[model samples]
Target: IKYLFINHYCTLDNLFDILLYTPQLCRVNVKYLCQLHDIILNEIPIILSNLAHITIEELDLPFDVFEIFIKKMTSKLQVLSIGIISMNFTYLDVNQWEQLISQHIPYLSKFHFEHYEKMPSLSNDHHNLLKQFTTFFWIKQQWFFEIHIDTQLNGVLKKLSIPFIHIGHVLNSSILSSQGIQLVISSVDERDHDILLNDYIKSIIISTNITCLTINSSMISCVLIELLEILHNLDSLTISYSSRLLKLHGCSQQSKHHNLSTTMNITKVNMCYVTKIEQVDFILKFCPHIQYSVQMILNYHH
Candidate 1:
């Protein structure tokens, strides 16, 4: 069968029987596999050698248990997500993992190893390893994926899926020189996004090549208007009044339109959350190409 779901815990005997009888099984979750067979540590390698040949495509296992197959070869295994509950990955230096990747799991494309502990910093070895790979990202506390730049980077960010996608693309010169380059951070976790906006966004934009931004924040309001107004290319804005937006009853009028639109600048304005209908009329007064509707709130809606 293509799927196998074991509702109860499995012991050593059950795993051996699975290897012998379930040759057709393509997926197996031994999350509850728990305690290993007391088959003496000397004999564990023999069982591990046999287990390595199984044609499984995905695996879920404890971090300590997976250390057995770190440098071992496995065929057809493409995806792996394991817990770092009881292990310290910093000890496994990047070169060690490079040997594992280049020699062992050559077919692996998507990998997520999560931990609940405080995040660790990437050492010099980490930077050396990342420079050789085509694409890889760090999943920060399961909130979002970040692909940051280092002094040794080549400024080529691949289009891939991951948490808090920290990206920088080289336009005219190297990415370091691309001043208006933008880092588009998107996520369903609004709380994490807000935290990123408050803490990390400023430092990142100031130190790196990030200017234009297209994002959705559930925490936007009048208190942050002056903050957002300074963004380089502020296009496609989303404002939700459900979070207590200051009403227009006691708002000041525009001394002059100042023409917020330019010939080749931030011209396209999308006014979403039509709580006040007059907002659309005000935009038409100074800006054209007005986009409305709840669906338009999404950057990819067009």
Candidate 2:
């Protein structure tokens, strides 16, 4: 097969077993790549010379295991996109990645890396993490990295990419179990702002049970309008306060016409950095069912 896609959970061994048969695979997309137990490998010559594109939605293995897999399975990888949900500090090793890419995927043109870790536990400062990603090799590859810290739920999100934007929920067990999963969606370039919401919603795994959402983008007002229309089950909403408070009314013209207050069953709204009372009032207009609010007015100077 020239193309292979696995949506179900597969161990590293099982993945290699499958690849053993498909030696001509040019593209592979795995939704969940994991290793539950000790993986014993049989020394077999596995060469996927045509494997140029690889995308792993969830990487649940150690970086060392991944390094071995990449070296053995791929040869001409042009695009590599992977997301990690682990506390392993080794995954953040910049030198390791530089060496791996240099030795294995020498002709790599694009790389998308996403790392999610529980905050307070992850003592590494975002600035230091950013500095680690801004090495000479990364600069040469033109892969800029951006770090986003979500303080409300104590989670840190860091993304490094060539020119791709990734949207996913922060990997938090406590928050996720309580149905308060938070998704941070942002575009790498401002030009893709128009289709950001639409593209993000489509990319995410369908789950209507998500009750909490935290938006970290500057276009929160308009994005909130889109969320209200789509995520009907969302109850708790959090957004950073921006200077474009008046844009709420202008952006919600559709909400004004349609009885949005009746359908928007959001019970809690958190404008954590509210600069004025008018912003709260405007939000309340859309979510009349909001029983709780955590708006803290601050002297937000531009």
Candidate 3:
């Protein structure tokens, strides 16, 4: 059979037998994905070693379902993509998530967390969960970890040591304050400019080894300046909001010279949603050895 479709009535034992015979199966999509929690608990050793790729649509799954699945599959599995079809926060608990990561999915190299019912909350449970996952071997290595939180996760992110971090929410000072983070992809939707002027931005400039930086249109001018100051090793920088550059009154000649002298190795810069041509000119003048690409958008988007 090219595919396998197991109904809710299928027992866990039957599912195990089906997986054993279909080692070459490329795509396995489950309907009520959470219902297989029992099967995973019983046949983790066998199921994880054979399964290749798993996609779950509805996310009403208990935290344990994921925990058991990841624990078993981390050693052999390669790609895991979970699509949360619901918005219910109760279905997934952050504490259980931590347990799953620390105890189970430490080896995953590529992880995608998408489409949750509600945004993730940064409670003790959430912090602990991310802490556990952040330290997973997958994250510790050079893997890409993407988190889509409707809420904030800086508190949790601060404690973890991951090479790359992508946050799709309004960031607080605590989120960007960490020094070891190498790559930051963020979307800022708020209008407040003062929050971006805090010491956190300065810290990111001086401390972070960030080489790839991507931000949405709502980013502030001061944030860009801070980024310019500390991007000593940055190779690729993508900005979704170009119009914000207009508000950057003027950089002191010394500051401009300092930025150029510091960012000697920058090669690629991506600018999106810029309304003024001057912004592009300004960046090109500062980074004379770099290449630039500009995209025009009617609205600021990331």
User: What's the CA error at residue 222 for candidate 1, in Å?
Assistant: 7.8
Q: Please, what are the lDDT tens digits per residue for candidate 2 over residues 1-302? A: 99999988888888899899999999999999998888787778688989899999889989999988887874689988899877666777778988999998898888888877643334424323434554557655556543332322232222321223222322222322242334454332333344445443333313324455555555545545665666656766666665343244454365442567778777776675677776677677767776765555465685
Local error of candidate 3 at 244, Å? Answer: 5.4
Among all candidates shown, the one with the greatest lDDT: 2
Residue ranges of candidate 1 with Cα displaced over 4 Å:
6-23, 30-65, 70-74, 83-93, 112-144, 147-216, 221-302
Regions more than 4 Å wrong, model 3: 1-26, 29-51, 56-67, 70-78, 82-142, 145-187, 199-208, 241-246, 251-264, 272-276, 288-302
Worst 10 residues of 2 by lDDT: 168-177
How many clashes does the backbone of model 1 have? 4
Candidate with the larger lDDT of 1 and 3: 3
The lDDT-based order of candidates, best leading, equals: 2, 3, 1
Evaluated at residue 12, the lDDT of candidate 3 is: 37
Can you give the TM-score per candidate against the true fold? 0.40, 0.53, 0.49
lDDT of 1 at 152: 13
Q: What is the lDDT of residue 250 in candidate 3?
A: 61
Model-by-model lDDT, in order?
0.37, 0.62, 0.46
